[model samples]
Structures are given as C-alpha cells and as structure tokens.
Target chain A: MSLISQEVPAFDTRVPAYLQRLERAMDALLPPAGTDPDRLHQAMRYACDGGKHLRALMVYATGETLGVAPECLDPAACAVELIHAYSLVHDDLPGMDNDDLRRGRPTVHKAFDIATAILVGDALQTLAFEALANAGAIDAEQKVRMIRSLAHASGSLGMVGGQAVDMASENLTLNIGQLESLHARKTGALILVTCQLAGIAARAPEQVRHALDRYGRCIGLAFQIQDDVLDQIADTATLGKTAGKDQVQNKSTFPSLLGLEQAQHRANALFDEARDAARSISGDAEPLLWLADHIQQRDH
Target chain B: MSLISQEVPAFDTRVPAYLQRLERAMDALLPPAGTDPDRLHQAMRYACDGGKHLRALMVYATGETLGVAPECLDPAACAVELIHAYSLVHDDLPGMDNDDLRRGRPTVHKAFDIATAILVGDALQTLAFEALANAGAIDAEQKVRMIRSLAHASGSLGMVGGQAVDMASENLTLNIGQLESLHARKTGALILVTCQLAGIAARAPEQVRHALDRYGRCIGLAFQIQDDVLDQIADTATLGKTAGKDQVQNKSTFPSLLGLEQAQHRANALFDEARDAARSISGDAEPLLWLADHIQQRDH
Candidate 1:
C-alpha cells in the first residue's frame, strides 16, 4: 500500500452523499408534483427542496457513529427535514414573520397563494410521520418510538411552543436564561431529536445515547448562536435569506444580549463541550466532532 | 330484571357517555390552559372543547360493534377529534375560508392572533400522533398502523388535498361527480379513518373492516351533503356558523351544483346505503345503524 492516505475526509465528503439520499427519500415520500391537488404537491416539494439538510446530516452522523446502516436512517433523516421544511413554510406566512424570501428565492406563500402554502405546510407535517411509520427497514416498535420522539419534539412543548414564545418575544426583551430556554425548545428540540432518532434506531446503550444527547444539546445551542452571529455579520446575498431580521423584528438574539465578541466566545465554549461529549462516545465520532466545528464556523 | 324494558336506548344513551370520555381524554392530552406557551395551549383547548363529538362517537360506535371496549378506543377517538379540530382551525384562517364563527363561537383565528392560531393547529396535529404513539393500551405494531392510517387520511392525498382543490375551486363551477370527489376526500377521509382506527385497535377481520369502511364512506358523504343542505336552509344561529357562505363564496356545493331537493335525495340514498352496510356487520351494530339515521334526519 502507498504511504498516502486512502480514507475520505471526515464530514465534508459525506454531506453530499447524505443529502442525496435524503432528497431521494423525501421525494419518494412526497406526493408527485403533477398529481391531483397538483398545486399543493408542487409547493410541498418546493418547500422541501434546496435546504442545507443540516438536521438530516445529524441523523446520518449519529447513525453512522452507532454503526447503523444508512438506509435505516433514511426515513428519519427525511422526517426531520420535512418537519423543518413545514415549519419554515408556516413561519414565512404573512401573519407570522411575513418573510418574502427564503434561501435566495421567494418563500412558499410568496411563490404560491397563502391558502396553498398553509395546506402545503400541513401536508408536509403529516408526511413526516407517514414516512417514519412506513419505514420498512425499521422495526414497528422502533418506529413507534421514533414517532413519539419526533411528535414530542415538534409539538406544543417543543418546536411549536418555541415559535409561540418567539412570536410573543418580539418588541419585548428577554434575558439570557429566557432566551436560551426559548432557543432550546424552538430550534434546539428538533436538532436534539435528530440525534435521539438515530440512537433509538440503533438501540444504542443508554449511556452512549445520553452522551450523544448531550453532544446534540450543546451543538444545537451553538448552532443557534452561530446563526445569530451570522444574522448580524452576513449580508442578504451570502445568507440567502434576509439578514439582520432579528434586530428588525426586535427578536432577542445572543449578540443582541451578550455582545458580538461574547456571543462568539459562548458559542466556542459550547462547541468545546459538544466536542468533548462526542469524544465520550465509543464509536467513530469524528463526523460529529467535525460537524460541531463546521456548524460553529459556518458563515450562513 | 323487571318486565318493563331495563336497557337504555342504544345510541342515545352512549352519546353522552362517549362525549364525556372524549372531554376527559382530550383534557388529559392537552397542556394546561396556563402553560408556558399559554396562548397556544389555550387556543388548542378552545378549538377542541365544544365540537358536536360526532367523530368521537363514530369511533365508539364502530368499536362497540367490534366488541372493543370504550377505553380501548379513547386514544383513537381523541386523535380523530384532534385532527378535525386542527382542520377547522386552518380552514378558518384569513387566507382560507375566512369564517369568523364555528360551533357558535369565534373561530381560533378570531379568538387568538393569526400566528397563534396557526401554531395551535400545528401543535394540535402533532399531539394527535403523539397521543396514538403514547397510548398505553395500544401495542407498538398497532400504533404504527394507526399512525400510518391517520397520516395518510390527513395528508396531501386526503383531507388537505381536498382543501387545496376546494380553495382552487372558488368562483369555479364543478360537476356533481367533481363535488362528490372533493367532499369525499375533504370531510370523508377522516371519518373513514375513525372506523379504520377502531378496526385496527380491535384487530377486526378484513371482511368486517371492509363493511365498517363502507359504512364510514357512505356516512361521510351523506354527512357532507347534510352540511351543504343545512348551509342552504339553516340560519346562522342554528348552524353555529355563517349560513349560505358557500353560495356567497361561489364555491360549488351539492346543493349549488344539483338542486336542493336533488342534494337531499342523494343524501338520503347514501344514508340508506350506510345503514345497509352497517347491518351487514355481525354484532351489536345498533349504534352504527342509529348514527346513520340520526345524521340523516337531524336539523342543525
């Protein structure tokens, strides 16, 4: 054998593979674009397409660390991405954030009518559970467990709860603790569940699962802080969405409360914590470690 | 036992019992009114609180015919009602039907802000799946099946699909067949799933399940026709919603497409079909039989 290394790079090399698998899985799960109720199906596909697929990456990463097969993770990765996509569609509605653009393109309600956007969001959410339940490779009991985890993470006490608080927080100031709690539920819950789902699918030991959970929690908060920092520093063109929306909406953010330098420092500290948690796991954790560093340093 | 009839009437006696069970079960499932996301939890409860409980009764009626205990059917009953409640919340949004009143109270969007209303609907839908997945009495395999069935009935090809078509159909004329197809998916899918859920819960034989499915489909269509008939003839006070809004919105309804008398005649024919299907089942099908007549003959 040659002295040169043959192994692929840790994280970047696998992202496109995971994203391609996720796209195929999600496309299969979604109703075809030209089917009856064509507009809704088309909008559902539109909303799900072209995302960064970060949450799905988390699912694949966690599953990979546990030695679970990628096909077993496909349904779950698709499910979380669908949930994320639906949330975005609803969040962009006129009564909510009223965002006209997303990912450098018109938002769902802008591309389609408001009624179709609402239905698209609703259908996408339903399709998430449907995908999980129909996952043939996963056992029935495990499927139930994943469904329960996802629904709990997405429901009133989870993501939607966070959105409610976030909407209420506009024009009102929130302290650091309150803000963390809000982010923990809003964006953090789904991110955390991405790890939990893979752990459940793999039937990982409780100790390993707990460590993975901790890594997920740390990474989730760090990801949000990075988003806040990017929202302040990045332009609309680079971000692919309107920048400085937090300040414009009067929504509190890490930089708004902690200052730019302090927010960056806090995110770095959390990244360290996430890396340490990843190290505590027993398997191939390099992907998770790289993911933490990558998420923390992403400009968008 | 005395010579005089000792048994309570079949359907009438069980109606109040089923409604009470539904109320208690739903109350247990919902977050308290003053929870962290207080507005959303409150609105979800408000949307679920005062419906006619017809859907829940269908679960009970079907389960009773299958010899499944009422408690065994509670989660499924609660789930269908939750789905129905979420549909109404979304359907009444400003961009959708825009109705201000439902069941004699202000619609969710009218009672709360539009953002909260949307989140309430989202959270409620999640809770429906959560309830099924967490149902203590249900086996995991059966839970997965129920989730699959519920999600299919609620997703793009089902209730939401119908809504999409209905939204697109505004100011457009449709044939009688087209109107039936729309209502069948819109109102009929969830109604059909209510029986399918109870059947799954009981593990009823396929032949019996098919009869129940047929009964549900017939009743579902008949129920929508009755709604259209009431929308034409009933006043706003009695109907507990805007009267004759279908004609005003220029959406084609059974009564609008066919004559009022013809629509009633179609509904009567469907009710007869439903009764026949219900009677073909071998058990205490009195409840299903009673439901068909009660739905047919009732006035708002």
Candidate 2:
C-alpha cells in the first residue's frame, strides 16, 4: 500500500481506460471560456496517471465481497481516486515535500509552475466532491455523507494534520510514540476513511464498518512502517525519489526511533491485527489476508 | 461598495464580537495535540479578524428581514463568515495570490509559513462543513444540502473555476464580458452561497431561495465592479493594499475594461437588479434592502 509495492497487482487492465474516462470527466467540468485547458489538463493527467490505485481497487473489491453491484461502487471508487489524486498534487507542492520528481517523472509544479500546481490541486479537491455529488447511482443523502467522510479524512484533522505534525517534527527530536501519533492522524485517518467509506457504500453493518476501519488503521501504520524499513533497505532504482533522504532531513521514523528489526516486528504485528480485524468482520476477505502478508513481505 | 463611496458606516458594535467567535470556532478545530494552540489561535485570529464582515452581515440581515429569528440565523451567518475567512487564507498562499499582507497584518502564510497557511486553509474549509453539519436546530438533510451548496458555490464550477481563470488571465487582455465572467465566478459565487445558506437555514421557500440566489448573483457582480472602480479612485490610505495594483498587474477588471465611469454605472445597475429581485420576492426584506444600500453606497 506504500509507494510502488511490487506485489500489488500490476496496474489494473481497465485502469488505463478508467484514467482516460477521468480525463474526459475533468475536461467536461471546465468552462469553455476559461484559459486554455491544454496545460492544466496535461499537468493533471501527468500527476493523476500511473498510480496502483489500491484505493479504487479496495472500493470495487468491497462491493464485490459484499455481493453488491459493481455499479453501486463505481462512483465511490472514482470519488476515492479523485481524493488520492488531489492529495498527491498537494503533497508535491513547492512548500510541502518539495519533491521535484514523482513516479519517475517531474512533479506537477516542476513540470508546470507553482501557480499552476496550486490550481491543479484546488481543482482536484473540488472535483472529488463534484464527483460524489453527481454520482447518480447513490442516494442524495448517501452522496452528501460520502462527501463529508472524504472531507474529514483528507482535511486538517486527518492528512493535513499529519502533514502539520510532520512539519512540526522536522529538524527536531521525537520518540517513537510521538512519531506514531503523527502518522496515525496523518496517514491512518484517510486509510481508515477509505475502509469505512467502502463499508458504508456497501451498506455494511455498523459493527462491520468499525472492524474494517480498524483493519485500515493497522495497515496504514504497517505501510508507513515498512516504508521506513525500505527507506533503509531499498535503493533509488526501486524507490522513485532519492532513498534515505528522509534520514538526510533529520526526520524521525520507525527505523530511526526503534531500530530496523523492531520496526519490522511492529509492522508484522500490525499486519496480523489487520488480518484479525478483517477476518472477524462479515465477508471472507482472503484477498485482504493475502494483501496483509504482501504488505509486510514486499521487497520494495 | 467601492472604497470612495460616501456612505460608510462606523464599525458595528457586535460584528467584532461575531468575528471573534468565528475565530474561536476555527481555532478549536485544528490538530488537538501536536498543534501549538497559541500560535494556531493567533494565526486564525489574525487571518480572519478585521475584515469588513459583509458576508456575515448579509447572512444575518437576510435572515432578519425574512422574519427568521436571530437564533436560526447565527449558525448560517457563522458558516458564511467561515467560508470568507478560509478563502482569504488560501487566496493569500504563495501559489495563489502570493500576498504577504492582509487587513494591515501579515497574511497567514507570511505570519507562519506556506505549509501552515495551506493546512490552515484546508482546515478552515473542512470546518465550514463541520459547522454546517453540527449546526444545531437544522434538519439533517438540509444541513448536508447547505454544505453541498457551499462546496458547489466554491468548488470547481464556481470559485475554483474563477480562480483558475484569474490565474490564467495574468497579462491577457479581456473585454467587459470576460472580466465580469471571471469575477462573477470567483467572488460572486461565494456571495451567492452566503445568501443561499441563510435562506436554507431560515428554511425559506424554494421560490424565495431561488429569488435570493438571483439577487445574490446580481449584487455579487456589483460588489466586485465597485471594488474595481475603487481601485482607480481610492488611494492606499483608504484602500489598504496597493490601490491600482489591478491595473499594474494588467489583471482584467471592470474599470480597466469598462472605464471608471462606466464601471460605477454598471455597479449601480447591478445593485438595482439585486434590490428589485429582493423586493419582488418579498416586501418584508427591509434589512436586505438596507444592506444592499450599504453595499452600493459604502466608503472604505
């Protein structure tokens, strides 16, 4: 579930087509009289394309596991994808991570300018809600609820909060506990929202939704923990950005705070927790069980 | 109203207190533990305080004239004020407006840093939805609907689209129609959302809501037209920021396109349209009429 995991099924066959459709959807939303869409669209496409789209797959898989219709999950899946896309755009802004490259190419701001990157991020954020609001297959209240769930997950209390904490910790010392708390609000919140949204879209029972939420929380941490592990073990060829740059920034991580062996054990434990939570809920999620193993065991 | 109009009112006694409460609501929603409450609080207050607070007045006065109780309107008024505050924070970000000063103080990003400013803006945006969602005495569906309205009015098709246009229009020549289209979307959209949110809170009839929306669209343009007009007539002492920066940037503006005299006349016509729409919809709109006059005849 972290960057470019080798075992995550190769980008879905339909994903390219879906990406195409997403572009068409985005283009249609822009007014004809506005500044040329050529550049904005190009930048949006560059940033939005090439993800493994685990979020979308989770959504579609959730519906399938629950015996719900694929159509029932299409909008939910697309809405989540939009959120993921928006998060990446904002994450790569000049002020945040300041990454010049992502997924083996220039980041949006690097390829375009800072102002265009900002608009790209803003447009994507708005488009996420726009997709949910106009998702014709769902109940209006359900769509509204979906928008609320996504907003909370991506907003200050969630990912942005995490970013804030990360910013606070930079050039400072922190223990493992504090670092974990930072990641929980930042990364865990949205992953939990992901699972909860899927469950809600499937109309799963409250108990089941809670269990899936726990599962996502565990996996989110496990994913980041493994990311720390890979930051030490992996090289730039496999990991997109320069490896060990996190260390250069004096950022605290599981590996730095708790040693690599201990971080590995913690990740394994989190995977176990995810498996247990998913298994205990309704629906046999053998694929999720496989995913938990895959996450802890991935090479890159 | 333009900065040079002759009918400016002294500061309303309670508007300051209302702004304070809005500031507190925004501050309370930041990260609970990692965030420095004092810094975040100071920034929120600095970012939101000292505005004209015309949006809240519109909400409060609109509800009042419609015969709705103050209690029913407070949350809606708070919500509009929150949106205005959020927009200012984002608009002043390095990639958007790159503004370092707002309301005679350092902008949020300048007061803190760009990342905090972005997060603060994101947080405020979510809090607007949270405010509407948790607003007491409002029906659940309508609460959700009002949240959607704010998003719609501010999102891609509205404010975001306007911003994209604004950013894209740097150094480009434009006619009056194009200038109006941009401002109508950027500033006017949110103004319309403010009035609609009030109508929704008051649970006004659909016909009245629609009529108020029309009124808002008209007055929203007038609001910006006057802003453009004032940029020409007012000096820095009265206008705060560089008085004629719009012309300096070659940014398309009403006065730039229509000339100062025509821009002033267009503003009056737009205000007239707003007044007629409000009155035709209901004779009980005495407060809205007064507010409209206040908008049309303001000084500084």
Candidate 3:
C-alpha cells in the first residue's frame, strides 16, 4: 500500500520542456505584478505561478494526440491551469479548507488579505474565460464550444458542485459510488474538460471527441484516486501541500472507504482503461500514454 | 439635491413587461431549487431572485433600441443579471463589504454559510458565461464576443479590479477623477457590457456599436452616482440594503467627493449625455432614453 511499493515510470524527456513552455505562456497571459491594484495582480500571478502543470499537460498531450499543434493548445492549456489555480486559492481560504500552504508557498489569503485572496480567485476565473475567448488561433465556433465546456465543467454542476458535496459530506460516511460521484465532479470535471477543450481546438470529429472524453474521464478518476492515496502515504514536504489533512478532517477518502490496496488496484485499472481509450484513436498517442503512466506512478 | 426633486420621466410601459420576461428567462436558466447539491442551487437562485434587476433592464432596453427582438436579448439579459448578482454576493461577504442585508433579504453568507456564499457567487459567475454560450438565438461568433466582453468586464481590469481599489481606498480620500475611475470598474463595467451584448446581438454596424458604447458609459456612471446619492439620503427600508455603509466604512463616493448637490447635478448631466448618445443612433431610441431618465430619477 505504500507509494514507494508501486513501480515508478521513467520520466518522459518531453515533460520538462512542455512545462517550461506552459509556464512562459501563463506568465505572459497574466497581468504583471506592478500593475495597478498591484496586490491583486500579484496574488493572481502568485496563485498560478507554480504547480505540476498537469492540467496544461493533459491539454497539450490530448492536442498532440489529435494532431493539433502545441501553439493552438496554449490558450486551453493556460485556461485550465488558471481554473485549477483559482480553485486552490478558494479551497485554501479560511472559510474553506483553511490550508496555509499550497505548492510549498504561502496560500494567497496568508500572503495577502482575505479580501484580496477572494478577489484574486474571482479575477483569475474571469481571466480563464477571457483567455479562451481571445485565443485567436481557434475559430469562433471552437471558442464558443471551449467556453461552454470550461464553464460547464467549472460551474455549479461541475467542480464547484463537487466541492459543495465534499464540504457537506465531511464527517459522514459515504459508499464507494457516492465517493466516485463526488470526485467525478470535484476533480474529474476540470480534467475532463481539458481533454474536451483539446478536442474542440482540434475540431475533432464526433467519434474522436467521444474517445478523448472517455480517456479523460478514466484518467481524471485515476488521478484523484492517486491523490487520495498520496495523501495517505506521502508527507507534507513531498506532496508540497498539507498531506493527511483529509484524515485529520474526518473526511472519507478513497483509502478510507476502500483499503489502500484496493484503491491502488482501482487506480491501476482506471489507468489501464484510460490508456485503452487513448489507443482506440487511430493516431499517435504517445503523449497521452505517457501521461497515463505519469499520473499513476508519480510519487508526489 | 433630493431624489424626489428630480422629474420622473413618463412611465415606460415596456419596463414592467421586460422585467417579467427576464424573470421568467432567469428562472428557466437556473437549476431547480430541489436539485442535488440543493443548498448551492438554492443559494444561487436566492442570490439572483429579486432586486431592481437594473442590469437586465438595460440589456432589454438597449436591445429594443437597436430593433433586436426581445427573445434574442433574454440570454444577454440573464447573463448580466447573473454577473450583477454574483458581484453583490461577493461584495456582501464578511471579508468584503460585510453587508448583512441585500434587497430586503439576508445576504447569502447570512442566509446560508460563508463557504456556500462564496461558491454561490463563483457558480453564478460561471453560469453567466455558460448561459451566454448556450444562447440559442445568437450565432457562435456573437456568443464568443459576448463571453469575452462579460469576462473582461467582470475580471480584474473591470469589476474585480474596481473592488480591489475600492477596498484598499477605505478611509482614504479620493478626488473626483479617482472616484469616477473606481466606479467605472466596480459598477460600470457590467452595465457597459449589457449594451455591448445587445449591439452584438443586433449585429449592429460599427458606428452604432460605438454610439451604444458611449451611451452605456454615460448611463453606467450616472447609475453609480445615483446609487451613491441614494446611500446618503435613502433609508435602509427603501434602499432594501444598508444605507450609509460607504460612509460608515469611510469609502469614497461621488457625493463624498463632489458633495450631494454637485453629485446630483453630475448624475443629471450624465443622464443627458446618455440620452444624446442614444439619440445619435439613426433609429427610435425611446427605450434607451427612457432608461437614462429612469436611472437618474429612481429613488432607490
């Protein structure tokens, strides 16, 4: 059940380069720290400055798999990352998860004031849609579809809705089905939309869209299960966030409902299903396959 | 300087009908109150339920002025109202304005919980964009434009930025120009976008769009100035929100900077400019003109 007991996949040589590109793009997209309302602009940049860039990677990977160029994927990539960052900023607020740290840095509310943190999150969420709308490489129709997809994924019925349920369900026992449903919205929705955005960017046919969506769903669930597992076995320094908080808060996690061994097995099965979905598309899928392995095997 | 001293424009029979239509559209667009995650959904509906709905009215009036059908304007109307609602929700939070009452009802945070209120604001903002994207009458291009406009208006450089400045400037004196700049972002941005959305919906010519933008700018500023004037003079029962909160918080306002009499004069001047801008368009501008008069004359 230990994370070290699981086999580690070899590092993909391309990930670092992709992450570097994404970081630069995001920096360019965000307002400079010196801008008027400097505190907010600074917080916005700080909240998004560092992360694993996994969501951006998913966007790029899916786009590459569908033969869409990386340049065309940058907006979707940056947009998804912004959404992820905003969620973290909100989730770490004093009224929410109340975490002091995120990605090894002081959370936005700690660094700035609570009001600034809330505004930072709000501004970042707005910037996500703005980034997509102005993604010039994508056509109007594609922009609309991407906006709809991202908004739907991030809204009440999607990521926010999931968080609501998660908050409400604290200290209450839930079956595996309920847990899966919660994670599907809380985390899976945004991840799923990253893939869906790539499909929109590529102007993929209906069949390819279906395949990509299926792949996204599987990987999304697998990723969360891995997160729950990591929270159990990983330390704060390794995870770069507060680990074991779920248990401390009496929240029912994957490891709480299913034993660590079964959760690990379930994550592995989802990873396999994700890879199969990617492979079903009749084209190069190296990036997606590597991502599947990376999600399952990453230690932190 | 008294609000009652201003001449009330002839009652526009269309205003009530438009409000009725907007209410119906918003109800249909929002998730049912009984849906799963019932509290958040219920909060979202509550946040948006009743107000003067001035922003939605602006959208309808502008669309009507441009000869766009009312049905085509419903999505834009709903979108603006949702954004307005979301801003109010966040503005009323304990860390923000700390208002306990809004539109004669307990604020979302007081009615529900702080976390739920935060999520409700976020979800409503997301729903605004989603609604615009799914607006059946508009073409994809228009939807993209509307999304971009709304996002830009609602984001840092627009409403949120305005809020940050407003918060930071507490207990500080701001000159007239600085006060205008603050209100321009905080309250003016969304109002401006309502007109722009209508322009896009009508497929208005470039000249008409420019004229509408100018008209929107004048009216947006006028509306905020009136709000400030009202806060100083109107009672809480009539305002349906806390009166004199700005003064209590030491936040700068039009009346604070310009004096009540001068602020009223400025609002009237802006109303006149707005009517002129609307009249400059080569069409019957009755609705827009009526809206301009209504904004300055409204007691609350």
Cα lDDT tens digits, model 2, A1-300, are 455544434223444654455455544544343344446656665667665566665665545556566566666676677667777777778788788776667778888888767767766666666666666677755765677787778776677667777877788888878888888877777767767766767788888877888888899899889888898889876876557868887899899888999999999999999999878874457556655765677666
Among all candidates shown, the one with the greatest TM-score: 1
lDDT, model 3:
0.90
> What fraction of the correct interface contacts does each predicted structure contain?
0.97, 0.32, 0.82
RMSD of each: 2.5, 6.5, 6.1
| lDDT-better candidate, 1 vs 2 | 1
| B189-250: candidate 3 lDDT, tens digit per residue | 98999999999999999999999999999998998999999999999999999998888998
Question: Which of the two candidates, 1 or 2, achieves a greater DockQ against the reference?
Answer: 1
Candidate 2: stretches off by over 4 Å: A1-42, A297-300, B1-42, B67-75, B202-207
**Pairs that collide, model 3:** none
Ranking by lDDT: 1, 3, 2
Fnat for candidate 2 (0 to 1): 0.32
Predicted model with the maximum DockQ: 1
lDDT of 2 at A157: 62
Query: On a 0 to 100 scale, what is the lDDT of residue B287 in model 3?
Result: 82
Stretches of candidate 1 exceeding 4 Å from the true structure:
A1-9, B1-9
Q: Write the per-residue lDDT of candidate 1 for residues A45-64, one digit (tens) a residue.
A: 89987868889999998898
Each candidate's lDDT (Cα)?
0.92, 0.72, 0.90
